[model samples]
Target: MNKRSLIYSGTLIFLFMVAFLIFTEQKKESPSGVVNISVQEAKGMVEKGDVFVLDVRTPDEFNSSHIKGATLIPVSNASGSNLSSNRLLEARIDEVPKKKILVYCRSGRRSVSASTMLVNAGYSEVYNMAGGINAWIDAGYPVVSSEDKETDGSQN
Candidate 1:
């Protein structure tokens, strides 16, 4: 090949690489718009009432114990598999009022799945609680049982 032709080909290849790298960086910064945050940070946001906290644990687990004011949307059933390939969260996307939503489970595993589901459902700001409710309890936060809540006369 001629020298000029070789130079032209090299320039096109370099431009393609640069474009690809930029696209990858953008994806990393906002992968489907899901962010993983610590429980402490989630608590602060919850205290401020700026985020909608989603509890993805089972109904029984949620009834037995749960963070105050968290919305229950159990991602999985008793079998450890969620409905519709975990698209259950997607179906309830409209229930989330706030632009930013925080999610948690018994541990951190299900929260990650729930977060990913939310992002795919077009939620722009989804935060997964790193250690879930277990971490929150370990951090000395309070959780209320269903019976306690019912008798507290704080029903809304």
Candidate 2:
């Protein structure tokens, strides 16, 4: 090949490599619109009342224990593999309200899935609680049972 042709090819290859690296680095980061936060950060946000806590766990799990003020929005069924078929959330999307929504589950995996769904649904300011309620409990944060909520409501 001619020297000029070889130089041109090498420059194009170098530019392609640079662009590929940048794209891959960005892919490694979290989804563009969703923010993953630690339990501590989540607690602070919840306390500030600036975030709407959306529990994506099953109804049984949520009734057993959940963050106070969290609205139950199960993204999975008993088998825990129906996240992609999240028709419940889809049908009730309006119930979520437009706000900074903080999503969580038992171990954080499902919350990630739900966060992506919310972002795709055009709900900006979405947050996934890293480690989920498991992390929150391990960090000594308080959780309320469904019974507690019932009693509190009855007394009020």
Candidate 3:
């Protein structure tokens, strides 16, 4: 083979190998059963009862405003010594099952961390909300404040 032809073939081979490696790595890291969904998608899931929405933000932040029906289990509260036993978590997340858990926080950061914790706890289906309540509110979804007064004069 000519020198120029040999060099061209080697370059093509290297490019093909790099492309293959990139594809394989992407497939491996891509979610299997777990899905990272948008705020609207998550809201639809919540409405359909297809997943459990978990607000991983602090209690104070959660109480101020959160997705309706979301269960609050702060990431900080669920880490380390707190997660050693099911007692505390059970009280907060009484109905959380080993099925699908959709987690979120102020942004995507805390939710990502909390999703790992849920998986470690043996929850099979874990979904991380790409953007948390901030995104939800930004999308014009309704939120219940901690001190919203109803016609009954009861705080919701």
Candidate 4:
């Protein structure tokens, strides 16, 4: 082939190789241990029984409103920057048997990070709530606010 043709062919080959590597890497990352579920799926899991629900929002936000059976771990508090070692979270995890855990926050971002942490911390099944509590309310699920606490008698 001519020099110009050879150069074009080499560039095309390089581009193809780059695309292949990108696709391969994506496929490898697709099987990440963290499971992401939509608001509907999370609600279904709660109804199914045997799923551990963790709310990873701040104490004030959590107290305002939260999932009925979820345990508040608060990702900010657990990272060793806010709270002191998350004894409450550790205790809850210890008390509850190993099961599928569904984690959420004000938005989905923190839940994703919290899910990774839980998986690393030895929880076999960890799921991040895709849209968080906002989606839960949008889905028409019941959220108990702090004012309801006195009447409900339910502890976090």
Candidate 5:
């Protein structure tokens, strides 16, 4: 390749690397104030009335089963890699009193996004369940299903 062309290509590669580094660095701080906790701890906190549970999974998943008393703030298109925005969480954030919010998903993938959103929204005590409901179930915790919950009651 010509000298000028080689230099231009080198510059482009350097710039791309710089941008990639910046993006990754920022991503590390993505959780910022959000905390991660074990499912067992979450259960204790919830039972002790120090934290409120939030289910960020889809409605279908929630309908099947979820932590007893967890508030449903569904987030569409949530996954481990992509933390999409949840209109429900944004619109009803005010309803979730300023307390330790324990967020979980089907298997903990979406909780990362939900917790991040809560922390970014200015909720100081936000937490993500490391393994979501799967961990909770594995810990021998009981979950509430749609058939068991009352119309307005959050728990069975």
Candidate 6:
């Protein structure tokens, strides 16, 4: 190969490597365009009342206790297949408004997948609580049980 051709190839290779590194570094912040937030941050946003809190847990778990005002949208069933989960979310997408959304589960793991599903569905500004409701409760945040809601409704 000629010296000039070798130099040109080397420069292209260097540029490609730089671009790859930059892309990967940004991906580390959030996978599939979903952001991850700490439990404390999630609490602040919830209190501010500008964000929609999504509980991606089972109905039983959600009824047991969950962040006040959170909307229940179970992401999986006993089978827990990705295809079924995606389809379920797609079917119920209308229930979720197109706004800032904070998603959580029992231990934060499931929420990541749920958040990704939301992002894939074109719902922007999605965040997954890093520690889930467990971390939120551990941080001394209060959760409202179904009984609490029932009692409140009974008085009205």
> What's model 6's TM-score?
0.71
lDDT (Cα, tens digit) per residue for candidate 5, span 3-105: 9999999999999999999875552233377777788778888889877889988666677788888888875554342434644677667777787788898
| Stretches of model 5 off by over 4 angstroms after superposition | 1-31, 78-87, 149-156
Clashes in candidate 5: how many?
Answer: 0
Residue-level lDDT for 106 in candidate 4:
77
Q: Return the lDDT, model 5, position 51.
A: 77
Report the C-alpha lDDT of model 3 over 33-134, residue by residue, as the tens digit: 345678887888888987777877766676778777777777665324344334334344535767778888877887877676666667777888887777
lDDT of 3 at 21: 91
What does candidate 4's lDDT look like per residue over 32-124, in tens digits?
Answer: 478777788788899998798888787767787888877777666633445656544543456444788888987688888777777777877
TM-score rank order: 2, 6, 1, 5, 4, 3
How does model 3 score by TM-score?
0.62
- Cα deviation of 58, candidate 5, in Å: 1.0
lDDT of 6 by residue, 46-156 (tens): 989999999887776777788899988887772343445554555787788999999998888888888998899889889899988888888878887866552221111
Better of 4 and 5 by TM-score: 5
Candidate number of the best lDDT: 2
Estimate the lDDT of model 2: 0.81
Q: 10 in model 1: Cα distance from truth in Å?
A: 37
- In model 3, which runs have C-alpha deviations exceeding 4 angstroms? 1-34, 77-95, 147-156
Model 5: per-residue Cα lDDT at residue 149: 53
For candidate 5, list the clashing residue pairs, or say none: none
Between candidates 3 and 4, the one scoring higher on lDDT is 4
Candidates sorted by lDDT, best first: 2, 6, 1, 5, 4, 3
23-78 in candidate 2: lDDT tens per residue?
76562227457788889889999999999999988776777788899998877664
